[model samples]
Target chain A: MIVVLSGGVGGARFLQGVVQVVPQQQITVISNTGDDREFYGLHVSPDVDIVLYSLAGIVDAANGWGIRDDTYNTMQQLTRYGNEDWFLLGDRDLATHIHRTNLLRQGKTLSEVTDNLRIQLGLDLRVLPMSDQPIATHIQTPAGLLHFEEYLVKHRSADDVQDVVFVGASKAKPAPGVLDAIKQADAILIAPSNPIVSVGTILAVPGIHDALHEASGMVIAISPIVGGAPIKGPADKIMRGLGLEVSAIGVTRCYRDFLDVMIIDEQDAHLTREIEDLGIPVVVTDTIMRDDETKAALARTALQAAGLTI
Target chain B: MIVVLSGGVGGARFLQGVVQVVPQQQITVISNTGDDREFYGLHVSPDVDIVLYSLAGIVDAANGWGIRDDTYNTMQQLTRYGNEDWFLLGDRDLATHIHRTNLLRQGKTLSEVTDNLRIQLGLDLRVLPMSDQPIATHIQTPAGLLHFEEYLVKHRSADDVQDVVFVGASKAKPAPGVLDAIKQADAILIAPSNPIVSVGTILAVPGIHDALHEASGMVIAISPIVGGAPIKGPADKIMRGLGLEVSAIGVTRCYRDFLDVMIIDEQDAHLTREIEDLGIPVVVTDTIMRDDETKAALARTALQAAGLTI
Candidate 1:
């Protein structure tokens, strides 16, 4: 089996490529919960949903989040009720939040709820939450200490990031099957997602980085950055805000301790030597997943870099 | 001010009539909470919503519940998630449940949450849940012990109800404004709602019955029954299941202790003497609220009987 550490939209799109290259049943994804939040009391795991929807081919491709053709009737009602509608929640998408929140309230762990969702969506691969405990990612912006969702969605990531804190993270343990899956996996792939506040928060969970440190297989990550900037999202802005270099080298450093192989985009080919200088092997490729072909090709390259013959 | 003890659909329509005659600001509704149940972890107060929607003139007139032209996108998603979608929840209607559940989780009382919903809906009058604490109405049917909505909505009232119980009744105290509203009301109206589960549950609260008994103004009731059967719903079925007379006399008997006057349909005129014999005054009219005119007429009669000059 192959294990993957994933974040939101970008990660979900990368997983689509991974599934096309790898046997679906052989994959296990540990999705980041740093972006998880409650809107109108519904526990919304934004990353997990994007993964599920993207995998099921039901995601709104244009938006990279929520179900395609979904209605916003509930959001309209919430607006009428004078609740802030900054974070858009579609009616069809609400079922996931509703079911997940309900099951969580009923004492089921996040792993169990995600597995149930996977089965409901007829997915072959498993998607486990990184941890069962609630870990809130609070972003310190000029606007105050805003939740990650507030920074990303509400503020449109316009504010310069001051700091990121994953509350309740110290006590968080990897969800059931997460560590074991990593230990027994033939390869571990980190999706092309934001390094900080995404993969960064996952590593902060007590036992997860330790499990990665001891993984028998190579831990490979595709650079989300192309030409010294993220292909999508506010990764560059956030990294710059946090005083981190905004390039493949910067991303490699985030996972440098446990990373075995780094894949850099063709545009950043000159940075290959610098990435490899960190004592990690580098694979040069066009890492941007522009279409289905590019996504599958990237996945194939990541697997091959981890010594998987495909 | 006038205080109306209410249930679902039928009572909501009656309230529409009430609002037509009485000034909106002069009205306060003590809505039954026994039928309140958690749907997918969201607290859903059916009767209170019905009353609010009806008073705000946004209710589905034909169905007597839900918002007009509402979509079922969320309900469709719930079905896809393999959850039983017996109780239909419109996408717009879900906003109320979601908001209510969130506030309740934040330690807001049902009264406060309801008042907030009232204000959001642009409703002028008060709509208070009968009690701040939860009180579940359970129905023992052939399908075993089912929640009120299950018996009513799921089974479509097909199964024979063996018993109707207001769970948590003993511990329930009247919501903050409930007792006070009734005591200080210029008129107390028991809307044309189910005696066994609707208004019955309100009376089941500790201080509500006594408040009605000591009401400064007339404690009046309009029988939900029009002839030998209720205008809508399983009021007759549940009444028969409990072995009570399913007619005007039966509804009057349900409120006999604190009832000062009862207004019933003309078809049940023969039973007027029977109700009056129990020391309550009676008025005969076409109690069915089929249109704006009928509803307004019924409200006019109830207020006139309460000695309201208007």
Candidate 2:
């Protein structure tokens, strides 16, 4: 089985490629839940929903999040009701939040709710949240600490991030089957997602980092940074604010403790030597996924780097 | 002040007429809350929304409920997620539910939330739920007891209603200002609504019935039944199921205890003398309000019946 650590849009896009190379039944995704927050009292797991929508072929391809052909009628009406309209919630996309919230309130854990949703959406692969307990990614800025979504969406990530705090991470237990999936997997690939708030928050959870280190399979990571910049999102700004190098080498440093191989873009081949100096093998290739062919190729490369035949 | 007891669509239509005759500031609508139910964990008050949307001039006039031009994207997506699709929740109308649910979770009473929504919607008149406590109107059918919405919307009222049950009425207190509005009103008008579930549910509340009976103001009721049938909804069916006559006399009997005057449609003028025998004065008029002018005329007739000169 192949286990993937994923975040939002970029991660979802990467997973689409992984599915093309490997049968979905053999894959298990441990999705980032730090981006989860309550919008109008409905629990919204942004990264998890992106993965679900993308895999189910319902994701809005242009935005890489929310369902395609979704309407914003609910959000528009909510705005009319004087609700804060910073986070846009599309009408069709709201079904996931509403269903998940209802299930959670009924005493089902996030993993159980996700499993039910995946089955309902006709997905065979498993998707688990990093933890069952609420863990919010708060970015400390010069202004004040803002929830990850508020900083990324509401403020457009304009604030300079001084630090990132994973609230409740210390007490949060890995959701059921998350650590088990990592332990039993033939290989684990960390998707190209924001390292600070996405992959970083997952590692902050109590047993998740230990599971990655103790797993018997080769651990591979695809660098989110390409040519010293993130392909999407504010990974570059956040990495810089945290005083980390904004390169493939910086990504390697973040996962150096458990990472066995690092996949970097061909544009960052020059940094291979620095990445390898951290005792992680570096694979250089064209990682920019512009189409299905390229995405499939990138997934194959990451899998092969983890010692998978396919 | 003119306090109007209301249910859903028919009552909302009557309220539109009430507003045309009386200034909005002088109106207080006590809407039924027993039709309120949770859909995917979101509190949906169908009756309350109808009154609000109608008075704000944003109602879908064709349907008598929901906002104009509302979409059902959310309900469609929710059905895809394996949710029961019996109750139709429009996308734009979902905003009121989301906002109200969020505020209720934040410890605000239903009345407080209604006030906030009213102000946001630019409404001047006070719109109060019958009670702040949860009270669901259930129809005891031959098959089994079903929620009012289920009986009406889901099953299309196919089963014979043995009786109507207000689940929380005995213990539920009238929402703040409900009884006070009745006691302090210059006149009270019962809108043409479903007496069994809408206005009936409001009156079933603990103190609301007594307040109407004890209030010094004249109480007037416009028959929801015109000739021997309701203008809309399953009022006649439910009334017959509960063993009540499906005519103006049956409606007069429902409110006979507190009713000082009865307003019947021109079609029901033949029953006016029999209605007067119950010690209630009768007024005949063309109660089918097809336009604003007709609605204004109906409102004037009801007000004048309460000894108010238009």
Quick one: best TM-score, which candidate?
2
Candidate 2's docking class is high
lDDT tens digits, residue span A29-110, model 2: 9999999999999999999999999999999999999999988999998998888899988999998898999999899999
**Given the true complex, what DockQ would model 2 score?**
0.92
Candidate 1: pairs in clash: none
> C-alpha displacement of B154 in model 2, angstroms?
0.9
Cα lDDT tens digits, model 1, B120-206, are 888898898999998999999887998898888887899998999889998989989788888889999989999989999998999
lDDT of 1 by residue, A1-310 (tens): 8998999988998899999999899999999998898888889999999999999989999999999999999999898888899999999999899999999999998889999999999999989899988998988888799899989888999998988889999988988888999899999999999999888888888988998999998899998988988888999988888888999999999999899999999899899899889998999998878899999999999999999998
Model 2 has an lDDT value of 0.93
Tens digits of per-residue lDDT, candidate 2, B13-55, equal 8888889888899999999999999999999999999999998
Q: Candidates' TM-scores?
A: 0.96, 0.98
What RMSD does each model have against the real structure? 1.8, 1.1
